[model samples]
Target: MKLLLFEDKLRENFFPLTLTRFTGDLRCGALKLRQRLEALLTDDEVSFLIDSSIEDLYSERHPDWQINLIKPGDKLFVNCLLKYSPTLFDKIQTLDHEQALVQGNALVAYRSNKDHGSFDPDSVLKQFGISTENVDDALYKHPADLVHDNGRMITYDFDNFFSDKDNSFETEPGATILNPYNVWLGEGVELKPGVVIDASDGPVIIDNDALLMHNSVVIGPAYIGKNSIIKVAAKIYENCSIGPVCKVGGELEACIIQAYTNKQHDGFLGHSYLGEWVNLGADTNNSDLKNTYKNVVMHSYNDRPPFDTNTMFMGCIIGDHTKLGINSTINTGCVVGTGSNLWGRDLISGYIPEFSWGEASLLQPYRIDAFLSTAQLVKQRRQLKLSNKERSLYTSIYHRYQENQ
Candidate 1:
């Protein structure tokens, strides 16, 4: 059977993160949701159906499949945004076309054949003669939902990652491994001396090509993704997901740092989600827990009421390509949008709009030309080119932000 991942209305709500990649591409555990799904369904053929705005980009990333191709066979359509339980794949494999698995109002997974030509989700229910059943699964519809549940998700992924495995990677002498039973290592990983890994509380995974510099301390349940680097003396606490190709340092806890970002200095980043291509300058920090310990509230577009995130540890949600200046402070529950360059001495709070500049209480819109030029340079530094599709995506998001204001 073939597996196809599809996005839903939640795509738009993802905003700054989905501005570049789809919901399936968002990194939560040690792996991207797409990667985890692929790993779980290793024997089946898999592909993605994402937003049209970034279709070409996603296609280029996965050129083996076509965006519109719905093959002539039995297919399983899976919602890309659902936080899948690794063990659920075993149950999913046992089911037949007689039943459909859904979570709440969202139709998460269903089966149909070539006789059903339409790829639209609404068509699947009517086309297939299957029955629907409500299944309890975590459905993520908003961006902050990632930050709220990342720790638990990371731990879950860790268990699925190494429950039946041994130390598959190499470690250097003098590298201390506490509770070795809970540590999972990937091939080609190098741990320098003076590094300590404490896995007693939960599982720890260091994926392939991840390097831990001397004196770094990694505590579980934590994840260091492929090609990522943990700089000297970095304190990575429980429940953090550091994605591929990132450079991390200082302290991080219960946070999700997406791919290609750099936080390689003394900084305190906790309970946050940093999108791709982000750069946190030296000594940057954010307030996660409030002094009063009240619930954190986040305001976004669409004139909705302030979202009361019942959690007390919600940090910043920084969008893609945004840069924070050295020593810049982000207040609790702040939402900074895509392509913004924040540089100043004051602490940032509340909602900062897309492509914005200047400092706290003195904000100004960043010009289009300046934003593009900097974006081009940033991509170049990472050996990537800013294509017309990316430029169009940025333009569309900029206008949407303007309209929301």
Candidate 2:
């Protein structure tokens, strides 16, 4: 049997990430969701059926293939699955609709309503019927899920602790692997002496070049992205995905920091997803939940009608190159657009437009000087200067959105 991973309606929900690849290319657990599905149905040949609109997204990544369509008298069967769970896949069945076998039983079908909406992280939550408390709930079923649940621990083992297991490590002298069950160290990684890693229950993944400084207590199911650093005395919690080349410290939990973002401060950030090139100031705190446990709503640049996320624990979805002020407090379900230079004491509304320069109130145009300065900092951090073409592209975006000011 042949299975098709068709991209029909979930296109918008997987933007930016999907902007570079197909939805089947997305990675959640140790394996890509689509790969897991293929493994489960090993007897079948699987192929992706990408929509024409998203075809360009995969042009450079995957080779072209003939996509099958349901037609009259076709004995084909199709199943729509969610990246979050395999149970959702099992619930699907094929039904004959008109002359074709329609792939139905989707928990959320593609809304044929002319008012089909655009993508926003929080809005996707409402469509999926997800509550913020359950944001990482599906991921909890991963082998690493239990590792992120209880958090990591640090205990001194005077004797040398050695692991015969492949991909295991014993860092410098005096460092201990108190709870090995919760910690999963990737290949070719090392640790220095006096370094402490705690894996009480949740799984901790120290990816390649992920350095744990002396006495750092990193909790489980927490991913220190490839080549990132955890400074001395850092505290990292579960449900965290720190992407490549980041330098982190203090505390973090249930957060997704895309590549090249930094939280190198003594602050608290929970239940958030930071885009590329973002920098958090020292002592920055974001409210993940309200005092009242009502559903969270998020507004975005491309979305209309404030949408419900059905989640009480939704935090912020910041765009690229946005910086937060020292002691800055972001509202729940806040969506800060790209190239925003936010600084000040006032707590602004959740939706801050792109290229905005402001102090929480009385915001204005972020002049070129400020934009270039931050851009330069990002360039230096990433070890690559922005090309003139890239600069021109950003300039175009800035001018286009300048009217929003």
Best by lDDT: 1
Residues 211-278 of candidate 1 have per-residue lDDT tens digits of 99999999988889899999999999988889989999999988899888999999899899999889
Off by over 4 Å in 1: 86-91, 94-98, 122-130, 162-164, 168-170
lDDT of 2 by residue, 67-144 (tens): 433322222222233433345334332222211212231222121112222322223334443322211222222112
Clashing pairs in 1: none
Query: Please, what is the whole-model Cα lDDT of each candidate in the order they appear?
Result: 0.81, 0.56
C-alpha RMSD by candidate, in order? 2.6, 8.9
